[model samples]
Target chain A: MAVEQVAMSSPDERITLTDDQRRRRRSRSIAIAVILAGLVVLFYVITMVKLASTAVDPSL
Target chain B: MAYVNDLNATEPVPGVSLATPRDYFELLKPRVMQLVVFTALVGMVMAPGSIDLFSGAVALFAITIGAGASGALNMWYDADIDRKMARTRLRPVPSGRVAPGEALAFGIVLSVGSVALLGLAANWLAAGLLAFTIFFYAVIYTMWLKRSTPENIVIGGAAGALPPVVGWAVLTGAVGWESLVLFAIIFLWTPPHFWALALLKEEDYRRANVPMLPNVAGAAVTAHRILYYSLILAPVGVVPSFIGLASPVYGVIAAGLGAVLIWKALPILRSAGTDRAAARGMFGYSLVYLFVLFAALLVEGIVARLGWF
Candidate 1:
């Protein structure tokens, strides 16, 4: 029955995704967002460290 | 938006449409960018002065972006010729995945942003070299020499060779002989490497009217020239060891790889324009030779820092 329904769909309408595929895509998107956020925080911390190091006097 | 009305507004959106994230990334020519980044990193690691991890990362990132900007601009300008070439027909601009205007804008923005950020993160000298590299590739090579001369790759190779120099400058704030040697190796390697590929793709370049060496000078002359360049490239590849920048191991490996490169070129020369496989082999081996040579240098640098060498 599922094969018959799939065969009946037009080529243009064949892009429909299964529930599992949609869930996987949503998980991928969230993973990417988390990674991006982590990178941003890392950059911020590095910049702060750089600034703090530059502020210290090396002669002492 | 209403000012430009068309009855036949289509799905592809008739020029001035949104591009996918992947399409924008494709405009960067990631493979070329990888080489640029790796060479630049090697330069940074080999330089005398030390850079903190954050600053080094920033400098490398800026160089990567600058290289990508140059690639995008080249794609934008060469869209017509690219459409004619089988290998480049599917590029973002030529394939109509990204509009030329959009590409130009993207490139310009990244070029300025990268240069400015590099200047802020590193020194102006490194940033200046980065700017010049982008301009040399986009304007001097792509706009001028590529269509006009058979010696295009020879002169244009300078832009590609500057990344290591720029990398060294990022830490030292000035160019040095060590970086110059790296630059020389790449500068000399470019002709032989590219000409080998051009041997195989001569017809495509001829069809596009690009005046590549094989297309203009005939394949036999091009093959001979590749051998000529390879001879010079071999010695230059080993210079880093003599100068104390790399270990003797690197020198030996570079010499062996260089000999193999010359050996690969020999078949192309003897084939008398008939050996497509020989040319392809030379092209493939050239890439591996460069990667291995540089990787050897990187390992030498690491070992030296660890005081194991």
Candidate 2:
């Protein structure tokens, strides 16, 4: 039996992810989360450093 | 086909992308990024100034990402030729591990983010240079020069040599003569270095129709040209000592290294070009030559910064 394009499944039927696709998606998601967290830390550290430099020196 | 169709469709599909994080990382060309980061670090250290720890760290990070972004864009654009070249056949984009759109998007995002971060941490000049380097690599070299001329690497090399200048500008907020000295070494080093590998990869480049020196100019001309470049590179290699960037001892060491590099190239010229063993030896030594030269400069920078000298 020829399966129609799975992408057009009825709205009520949720699409099922293949195991390989799910695994890859999960790994990518974790990587993105780590990178985003790293960015947050980076911004935090930059702010502190800038604040400290200004506090230590008020000279023009 | 269905998956590809789903991806490009106007309505969002529920299918998950098969690209893994590692594939994305591979798209960055980590090895090239490492060299960019190292040279930029040397440039920063050699620049006469000071940076806070945080800002310095951020500058390096931004430069690294910028270099990787350019590498990704190179891969994205060259995916067609990469598929043909044995050396580049397994690259993420060519291997189908990452989609072309994904790689392009990844490169664009990193390029913008890196340049913005650099502007905040360093100065506008550094950021501008980084942005220019990306554009030069992705557009000027990859899109234009790479296909049309055998002298592609000779000119495209400028893009690679700009990292140290960007690094110097990060700390100094302007280009300096000392930074240009670093840039000159890389600019001169590039032709001989790439031509040596070009001799080895002649077939691969021919298959890809990339117009590498050997593919267009023949092996004899390529080998002779390599010799001429090496001859010029030898003296330039030791200019740091003459210019006060390094101790006289470092100069002597650099000269000795240069002599050995010239010695390695002799067999290629003696054989009337394309001596396989000579090319292999030169390729290996060329890597060591650049690394040691930069390492010596890095040591000088460290010693001067610490007042050990």
Candidate 3:
């Protein structure tokens, strides 16, 4: 019974869950991470575009 | 106008919150400060004036601090509406991380400190503009216009657009058409940029009872307004190049981007679903537009200094 209880707990206390629960949590985290990463990339692109638009001639 | 939050006396404290120092800092709205600092720096750079490294640094610091002060005061005043909005719910006063009184005090201190620093490091003209900018944003924009009308952001944009003017003043100790043109660029840019955001977050504004364009006007009207403004913005963007502050290179780019902006806006006016994509694209492009325009001016200034022009 003790071994069974131990088996029920995942190794990662950060997300203590059954195997199925662990799998779902992991997927959700990946999705959120991806979204955040995408937002960061988008922000970078916008910044670069802003920098590029302003080239001017010396006379002007 | 609600300089103090009604809920400041009533809301329960949050279990999860930042420290007092963090909350105070948050009240300044760092992102807005960043915009203010950048525009002001660009204005300083593009102006026909000279400053040693130390004085220039001091001037920039003063302007940034002044911008931050305005943010603090805006936060101090808007704590009530902020508490009501999910987006602003986590702000210091709303979340009970910092007391309204503390935020108010912080703003007042920074406001005075920034003005004094600018006056000492730069000149009275720059200092005066900084003071006016703070008042214009905190009092005029936040305290008065924010809750009064749907056109609040439109009119309030002037305060946001003044940093460059303030920078120009710092360099020349006077105003000129060039700085005014820079001001005009931003003044025109603000409506379309914010209207798009307002269109996207109409529900949030409605819940908060703020009179953002989308909440006050129907979607169709808001879309029309966006298109109308973009149409104006498109042509006006080319003026800097014509005025000799920028080159024809900037002119061509501005014209190209302006056309795209107008194109993006057309579908938004015709239908609501397209509003989001259009708004997002416009808002994103608007940043690029201003950045490019300023970069052009900066390049012109640098080249002229190097005797290349």
| Single-chain TM-score of chain A, each candidate | 0.71, 0.75, 0.59
lDDT value for model 2 = 0.87
Q: What's the best-to-worst order under TM-score? A: 2, 1, 3
| Model 1 Cα lDDT, one tens digit per residue, B7-96 | 221223342343556677888899999999999998988888887788789889999999999999999999999999999998878877
Could you give the CAPRI-style class of model 3? incorrect
Question: Would you list the C-alpha lDDT of every candidate in the order shown?
Answer: 0.85, 0.87, 0.78
Candidate 2 per-residue lDDT over residues A1-59, each given as its tens digit: 11123444455544456555577789999999999999999888887887888899977
- Model 1: how far is B27 from its true place, Å? 0.5
Q: lDDT tens digits, residues B93-123, model 2?
A: 7776677888999999999999999998888
Which candidate wins on lDDT? 2
Which residue runs does candidate 3 get wrong by more than 4 Å? A1-60, B1-20, B272-274
User: Which candidate leads in DockQ?
Assistant: 2
Q: What does the lDDT read for residue B266 in candidate 3?
A: 81
DockQ of each candidate relative to the true complex:
0.05, 0.35, 0.02
lDDT of 3 at B304: 75
Query: What is the Cα-based lDDT of residue B162 in candidate 1?
Result: 94
| Higher-TM-score candidate of 1 and 2 | 2
Q: What is the TM-score (0 to 1) of candidate 3? A: 0.77
Worst 10 residues of 3 chain B by lDDT: B1-10
Question: What is the docking quality class of candidate 2?
Answer: acceptable
CAPRI category for model 1: incorrect
Per-residue lDDT tens digits of candidate 3, residues B187-299? 98899889888877778888889999888877788888888888898898889888887789889988988888888788788786245877777778778877877777677
